[model samples]
Target: MSQEATFKSIVCEIFGIQEGDVADTKTPEDIESWTSVTHMQLVARFEESFKFQFDVEEITEMDSIASMKNVLRKHGVDL
Candidate 1:
């Protein structure tokens, strides 16, 4: 699957939501399941699936799907 597809799948699984709900503009404020603990879980899952470690700053910057895409792109991820 493509990186974007994989990303949406992960987010859907993590947030217990449907694929249609995972949008680039969605943030923690928009998702009830996106708590602090789940946010770390997301970071771990993303790092594991994408094979890249995110530094503290990048982790903090990932407040939304769009921001996560930016950080992943900075790490040379194609999507």
Candidate 2:
């Protein structure tokens, strides 16, 4: 799979949602399982999925899938 597809898969698996249903606008407020603890889990998922760790600011800026992709790219991740 492409990096984008893998990223979506990780998000879908972490949030218990369908990959097809994911969008750039989706956020914590839009998902029932996206609680504080789950947010940490999602962060960890991203780190593990991409094999890179995010700093505090980067973690906080991961508000949506679009932002996440942007952050990942900023960190030199191709996705």
Candidate 3:
């Protein structure tokens, strides 16, 4: 799968969202499964999947799927 698809799939799984519901606009507020703990878990998952370390600024800015995607891109994650 492409990096975009992989990212979407991982987010959907972590948030307990359906594939059809995955979208750039989706935010933590949109999912019942998304909370502080789950947010950290998702960050760790993204770090592992992308093989890159995120700075505090990046982590704090990860409020939505689109932002995360941009961060991954900025890190040159072979997308």
Which one wins on lDDT? 1
Model 3 compared with the native: what TM-score?
0.88
Q: Report each candidate's C-alpha RMSD, comma-separated, in the order given.
A: 0.9, 1.3, 1.4
Can you tell me which runs of candidate 1 are displaced by over 4 Å? none
Which pairs of residues collide in model 2?
none
- Give each model a TM-score: 0.93, 0.88, 0.88
The TM-score leader among the candidates is 1
Report the error of model 2 at residue 65, Å: 1.5
- Angstrom error of the Cα, residue 28, model 2: value is 1.1
Candidate 2, 1-79: lDDT as tens digits: 7888888887888789997768888888888888888889988887887888899999899887789789999877777
Query: What's the distance in Å from true for residue 35, model 2?
Result: 1.1
Model 1: lowest-lDDT 10 consecutive positions: 3-12
Model 1 TM-score relative to the real fold: 0.93
Evaluation by lDDT, superior candidate among 1 and 2: 1
lDDT of each: 0.90, 0.84, 0.84
